[model samples]
Target: MPEVGVTYFAGTFVRHPLTMAVVHAALRHMRANPGLQEQVNTTAERLVDRLHALLAAEGFPMHIGRFGSLLKPEWTQEPAFGELFYYYLREAGVYAWDARPNYLTTAHGDTELDRIVEGFEYAVGQMKRGGFLDDVRPTAQLVTLASDRTSITVPSTESQREVWLADRFVAGNSLAYNEGLLLTLDGALDEDALRHALQTLLDRHESLRARFSRDGRRLVIDHHLELDLPVHDLSGLGEAERTAALERLCDEEMGRTFDLRRGPLIRFALARLDERRHRLLFIAHHAVCDGWSGAVLLTELGAVYSARVTGRAAELDPAPRYADYVAVERHFLESPVGQAHREYWLKQLHDAPQPPQLPPDRSPGPDPGLSAARVDVPVDAELVTRLRALGSAHGASLVATMLTGFAELFRRCTGQDDLVIGLAAAGQSFHGQGQLVGHCVNLLPLRLRLDTADGFADALAITRTALLDAYDHQGVSFGTLLPELELTPRRQSAAAGERRVQHRRARRRHRPRRSGCRLPHAGAAGRDLRVVHQRGRHRHVDGAGGQLPHRAVQRGAHPRLPGGLPRPAARRLRR
Candidate 1:
């Protein structure tokens, strides 16, 4: 026999409408009218009787159980929340502590039914004398069906279309564009306030309340109510233990795949390590957000969190809904500027030189897995200064020098003088794109034609020119570039929602969405190394080397070659 205080339910709390109605209605009606004990009981009984009839008519088992007698244990689905509270009746509380039955499920038996009615009757009498009967109205939000919870549908932005198509081509792999961030905050944190701040963001940004799904062959997104933010308490653990556990948690959450098909797409966690320290992590699929958007989220979240703790409302700028981006994206894709940019990319990559091939630790059978190992090659302060000096002399910045160095690295690896690398540029140069949280990155191909006789200085010069030229046509989504260059990603496997890209040899270079690193493609038949510069650090994730060494540096012969240094210093570094 089940424990005496156990509660049971007949169906899922969410799927069973009648059970939900009975529970909610009982609580609401009882709270609103403590004087009408007899009427409340009558109403509850009538509701249960009608529910039983409806359930029985639907061929479900709904026989009444004997008082305090055990029946078959297969009729309920319990530990109903209501029953747990049924026993929470204080002498002056409205809830029927000893008499309320838990939720109804298929596993519930006779004793449960008797308890439900008894609990309701006793609770009504007690509540009439106390807590819930007090005249403060319940905080029920008044929302119109047509206003607050509006669902807006729109076509996916070109960037979304790009990743969605790539995801489809990966057979069963869902790693096309998922990205994450983990920030450790020093000082105290209030979880309740944190949750509220996050909720504020969700309310302010439509994309946060969005889901992506296919409407037949066309890709679309539907915006709905904001997702509930999740927080965890690990403040009880030791400082040392909690820090380790926090890292593991961050990894697990970041690596965890998102279901873009039915998405909140964004995942968040605030691990409370101690009263003075906390770690906050945010993970989102690239389709809903880009690198720039991630920073925007953090800045806004910080602003909101601070304002909340101090009792001030956050004055975030009016959020531009994701739908607006979709409309704007569509307009640009058909505009003259878009056409002009498209022409530039097409011309730039038309005869794109094959990327330099590097012998991988293993054969890259296919280029679709996200399993990666991080390789960090350190550059001391001296090297950084020299690189900056070189960049200044050449009228190029450190990023340009890095790009130039990478071009030289490729040439050496494959004995090829001409090579192409991918670079990610912010797509915010356009008006109205300054604050939206969605995919808005420009992936531009930096093609370099070199000669073996060219010195490091000459290589930087070529790279600097290419970088400047790239600025002219850096607005188009890289996904759009693929089709334009006849380099659509091939499907390793096919299923519903997969775009039919003709299996053709890749004619242009490809880059990962957020990681600006030039990706190795099937056209080369050999792996090409990629370099990702993030947060002032250059980390290489082994692509084909799906299993990157824990601390291996898959770098070129020159350790300082990893990052591009600026101009006259470029000459000094060459030494």
Candidate 2:
């Protein structure tokens, strides 16, 4: 071969720049962490050992093969079982290619490996029960949809349907679904650059331009939508005057509601604070956005603006379609697994307690015309740190611990041993749903029973168990569960809007400090972990400062100060 002269052609084009860069970065990371390969191999072997035992014990005619960190299923029975296994695996929250090996890496740790084994066990059991091994081919349940440049229409998801029903109950008052975010920038202002960034964001996220059908049965997303950025110049005014004007603008923006069927579910405005400072206000309907999307919108906006300023392309993954999520949810709802989840909820909530009533200053009545009365309860960092430590000691999260305390508060106020607390969860645990910018929050009812003999630790343990059970069965929405239990909507407002109480477990964001953009603090509420209790139709947990401040106002309401409570209790949670 060396003696013979041959034409050698190099295929340099095969290596794309992006691919090469990723490879190089990965190599560098591997070099920096010399034991990464060994760690990954160890995890893979652990998984293999557990899965091998599981398959042998379950008497499945299949085995798993592993070469280093690569794993694949080897079937001893019919080959068609591979396809059947894929569907079952997906239902168990494991996404993989049919009959193809999955590569494990340093990112797969003990928690992930345990989940893999559990998913395999669940998948195998489902296949055996469903008689999938008897017939590899059943009627396909997956729904595939096509869309053009004009619009993408998909059936409404349970979360979206809940919003629609809430809207109907409110008699089309859009404020019940309105939410907003405000960001303060401390640098040179660029109106044109901001405009370009806004347009790019609209183009990137289809949900921002989403519109509902007249009957609220479908979600339609336009492929292209023009940007409308309203800039309010307040730099010419005095500092005090500017502050007043900004407050008024926020109130006005929050007050402006959207017609779900008409158009424009989101609004943007920029206020010029000074030569070097600016504030950005963004408002949208709850149908189009949620707490998680707030972070996504800003992150993408920052990435786009940075790329535009540097004259380079923004590096972002392809936008995942919300319609795809709708299809997947519909498939689940029609499956036997969904029915089992519904049955679990029905049994658990059959004898649930009625909603607790908070003590009111005046008799509870309609106060639609009255302004919101803000209540601020400041929690110290030291107290929060101790509470978190207590939660960790008992294998509980801060959320569960706080929910226990919230239950105690209600018990003290209403003298009810049994309490039901509404918890709002961001239902984004699906394979491709993490990066999605749509409304997928599910409200859960957490029922807790308190005995006078129970200690704090015992109470927390009970709360933790209840919270975990709720999460496992959260696939069924609160809206769907209501009619199943022969119960009317828990929340009813004589006024046209929703009354919500929120209890949030806040933690500081640990990120590298950057100069371009930052969230400005709003007095004590921003700096402390606050608990807000409203005698309204619904109560849930959410971040405090990011939402519109005007919605916090409720007339004829009084804040239960520390001095107002019993002496012994004032020295407990609030302290």
Candidate 3:
């Protein structure tokens, strides 16, 4: 088996002297500290053993040099550059580590070059102050081998500078730390008032004020902001322009790294567009917030803003800090609750079908990136009412109805009775007090199998059952479940399979509709009944028969039935 050892200086793995020097230096450093010396020695010894094991397992030569200084002809053999880029991002708090060559090129235009230079200077200043690098640990992994057989040099570019800044500031903070927020508001509002409200909301939430940093490889948080936040106006721009700007800003911000040795590790931006509308973007390295934090920020911001605008004192009670949630989560993970949840997921998804096979790209290249198109299905008041009535009749929630509808569509498309699709669940369920802005959002994979012979109501019930089962086991992170489920992509071949099986499962599950609407009934009953349905878009399909017959079916009382099944119909609607 190949050996594993760390090298302080740049060299080939064959040079054992260089590697041994590094190991000796590390040992001396460890010995200097009575407590850490023991810990470091133990860790280093174990890591070396693991490295040897890894080499034996992969049958690949093992080399441990500064990652940035390593070079091999085969490095360009595959898309290894991308993989290495991500590896550096994880290990060294840097991004685009493989883009050294591209970064060397500078803008020819004097003005553009000047701007780039300014940005680079700002980035360098930030780096020095540990501005972006405040909470991040330093690593020797930033070194990169030259593209040609030449000495490695740090290349410069505006994009690279921004990325470097963000990576220095943000990445690897914490898995459950805060993710930024995207807020959209109605077009009639006061920008200053909104900003004030947001500030107040931030002040109220301990997580918003939390400070984070890296204590070596470990993340630590202090629940308070190091700097005051400033809100800016971002109104009167086109959607594309706004999107582009936000993307750029996000990219720049995400690239920054913070010095953990410093006090605070958080930043906020409020972009307003006119008096009535705006977006508030809060970018915190994960060490500070998560999905739950985003929702908490939104809810609290809304409430605090509303209160300030209306001249009412906010009455929110004191809630526990994010550290509390961490404690709770840790406890739950170790407790019976986590084990039970895991067991439930194991049972529920044991035989689940894979995710749908997305349509092949028509793009010209063989890029591995994804392209997506969305079709919006509007549920007007009347349609919403009808769907709600149907769901009510079956004692199902609106989400249950939609899930059933989607299940039918899936059956038609994949021709598989057993199917699994992902669902998003908001993780708030009567947890402790305080403004709960953290990663509370979770993805849940729901499995539904349709017995072809079953009626629509039966199918709906099955969907409802599955949804409820998912809800019951929703505490586990979808992030965790995804890997556990080992969901393979739906195969094109399986799309033609047909299983004529019938099974009846019983239960009451509450699947709430995404939205509810109240519409006046046209019948003599004269009831103003509320209808609930999945909020966003719904698919419309031509009935199973010909165009004219399909139109007739839509016009007829059974408009929803014909579109519920059949491959051609589902495909047409999906398209």
The lDDT per prediction is 0.53, 0.63, 0.43
Superposition error at 536 for model 3 (Å): 8.3
TM-score of candidate 2 against the unseen true structure: 0.63
Q: Report the C-alpha lDDT of model 1 over 1-575, residue by residue, as the tens digit.
A: 33464366544645453775687777787679765555433444443554344333332222222111211111111222323323443432333323223233323445545555454445434444444334322222211111112243456766666667656554434553556666667766687788887777777776676656443123233324545556677888887887778767765675566766545678777777777776677777776777677667777877898898999988977988777766676777789998998888788777655433454545545443444433344555666567777777878887776666656655665577876566666665464477777777766666677774357777788877877888777768656766556432332121111211111111111222332222211111012234554323333332323422322223334444534542211111100
Write the number of the candidate with greater TM-score, choosing between 2 and 3: 2
TM-score to true structure, per model: 0.63, 0.63, 0.48
Weakest lDDT window of 10 consecutive positions for candidate 2: 139-148
- How large an RMSD does model 3 have? 17.4
Off by over 4 Å in 1: 1-148, 215-224, 365-369, 486-529, 534-555, 559-575
Model 2 CA lDDT for position 344: 82
Worst 10 residues of 1 by lDDT: 499-508
In candidate 3, stretches whose alpha carbon ends up further than 4 angstroms from where it belongs are: 1-196, 209-219, 226-295, 306-313, 361-366, 370-374, 430-435, 479-575
Compared with the true structure, the alpha-carbon lDDT of candidate 1 equals 0.53
Candidate closest to the true structure, highest lDDT? 2
- Model 3: weakest 10-residue lDDT segment is 521-530
